[model samples]
Target: MANGFEAAMRMMRSRDPQRAEDGFGLLRDRAAEYLPALIEEFENEQADRGLRSWLLELIGLAESAEALPVLAAQLNSQDEMLRDWAVAGLTRLDTREARTALWRARANGTIA
Candidate 1:
């Protein structure tokens, strides 16, 4: 993870709404640089559902190609909102693999 990212993660994880909100903005601003760190956080199973969802949203906003795999994986998630965020990220990426995954997910019942 890059410098300041850990702090941003802490802010994102903060229970206080204000801190979390600010952290989300910071994550969006550093979306590209924070891609790997955010992906790592998303991969952690210890997070509650809400935090996982927030991380997904952050990754989508980052719009990094590296996140395609992660977003594609989320297409199969049972959580509809998670799937939506994955689709959103894939669309933002607009790469061949990401677009193909989006199409496949849409056709295969992953994306609604």
Candidate 2:
């Protein structure tokens, strides 16, 4: 399972956007199993920008409120791009906690 998850992530980092989207799409269906890896990749400075963006979109698709804390921590990332993506992902969550966290991050300028 781990190997498969890693392969999916590698695909998501591929140069082809279609491949990346497909990889992320597969992970979305198994979000509970992939959330940790997704969060890890999102926080990895070495990860591709496109892959990170796609991961954020996947988080939104997963609607896993469990990802909220990790996403919130990203709100404090030094990279503005990461912070922005984190904010965007948070909005996808329908929970009140997600909304509250997003509002706070926005008010504090973590996101535009």
Give me the candidate number with maximum lDDT: 1
How many backbone clashes can be found in candidate 1? 0
Kindly provide the TM-score of model 2 when superposed on the true structure, using C-alpha atoms: 0.72
Q: What is candidate 2's local distance difference test score?
A: 0.75
lDDT of 2 by residue, 1-112 (tens): 9998988887777778888778877797887667777777766735466666667656655668778887777788787776776777777775899888878877987676
After TM-score superposition, the amount by which residue 56's alpha carbon in candidate 2 deviates from its true location, in angstroms, is 2.3
The root-mean-square deviation over C-alpha atoms between each candidate and the true structure, in angstroms, is: 1.5, 2.6
Instruction: Report the Cα lDDT for residue 51, model 2.
Output: 65
Question: What's the lDDT for residue 103 in model 1?
Answer: 87
Question: What TM-score does candidate 1 get on C-alpha atoms?
Answer: 0.91
**What tens-digit string does per-residue lDDT give for candidate 1 at 54-112?**
89988988877889889999999988889988888888889999989988988987677
Q: State TM-scores per candidate.
A: 0.91, 0.72
